[model samples]
Target: MEQRHKDLLRENRVFLIDNLIMKNFIDHVAELLTANMEDTIMSNATNHEQVGCFLNILERRGKGAYQKFIEALTDAECDHVRSHLEQLEDEDCVDGYDDIDGPIRQETGNDDVDLHVSDWMKTDLSEEQRQTPISERAMAFVAREAVGVMEVGKLMGFTEGRLRQFQASSPIPSSQISTMFSAWRSQKGKQATVENFVRLMRDAEVDEQHLKNVITREYPPGDAMA
Candidate 1:
């Protein structure tokens, strides 16, 4: 009887562990899909063939095939996938699944500067909008305005061909962008207003006298700028 009980416990543990791992994988994929679709919907040209190409590269790189699949998913698909996976995970937990490999991990592999914007902007992007790296996030801002590569390049003071090359190389994953946008929506940046700054300075008891003293000491006679 004891042996039977031990075997049953072992089976339960295996089941729980598998389910938990599956849940984490699904969540990671969802984020990938979100980032990919932050701007343009996946084109008809981007069928399974392109996805397969990415999967092949990822598998070769040992980054996980499932993750590449998620990155290839469309914005619309990601929303559904995220919901379904979340539901499945919740059900497993309710049924006593508790063996997570770790707390959720964020996807942070791709860092090509060209992919900074569209890669961080697209569908339902609350999280990306909030936590996207500044450089990447800035691109999305310009892209949303429909600023073409040439226009953006001009703004950045780069040549058009160079900008296009950058854009081509750093193709943004819609899933990642979507998740970032979700985060973005719920967050607010610090308002760099005069009133707010003054309020903060006052709260800290900083006044013109403090500023003048620091400036005078730092400048020291002829070193002061006009």
Candidate 2:
């Protein structure tokens, strides 16, 4: 009788440990799916492929365990999971479901540069928008508007010839322009106004005079010009 009692206790302990492990595994999978869902949805892409890959990994790791894990959840919990997945799928459709292009930008009349930058930063940009090189005209306009070309050139460590070349070139590689912008921003004490103008010029269409006026108003003759 004592031997039988010992055996039953051992069995109970094993069952408890197994239950604990299964609960942990299920929680981990849920967390992963939730994170993937958020990332995919926010970036305006479907998570089907990622979710499928995750499930495949779970199945490969332990098919029986995966099945048991699914069975362990209550019907309501399962429904909740399915609902979230379906909602994300629907959102992807509404978001245009293009990973390469991202969500389409809706044109709005509000051209307030600060507000524009704030809104623009909230969404993912298209590949072309991110990859396309900055035109020299655009760079020149930004420099001429925000800070003088001489100051930009000095901050960017450009030689006189290089500065002249940059002014003359039509499209400078985007990477170089990014470096210049970073340098300019750092030198300007990380001013949001300067950062906003650079981001606006790089990401959106703007009139030269309008941008110039915005910058001129923010930094009068002696402030940034000096």
Candidate 1, 170: how far from true, in Å? 13
What is candidate 2's lDDT per residue for 73-152, written digit by digit as tens? 44325545434434554565565553322322223333543464444333323323323333334444444223223334
Q: What is the clash count for each candidate, in the order shown?
A: 34, 0
Question: Across residues 1-226, which tens digit of lDDT does each residue of candidate 1 receive?
Answer: 1222222323344332332333223344443222323222233244333333322222212113233443433332455443444455556556554333111211333343223232322222333222333332332342322212332234334465555555565445322222332233333233322222222222222223332233234323443233
**Relative to the true structure, how large is the alpha-carbon lDDT of every model?**
0.32, 0.38
Segments of candidate 2 deviating more than 4 angstroms: 1-125, 160-226
Question: Lowest summed lDDT over 10 consecutive residues: which window, candidate 1?
Answer: 54-63
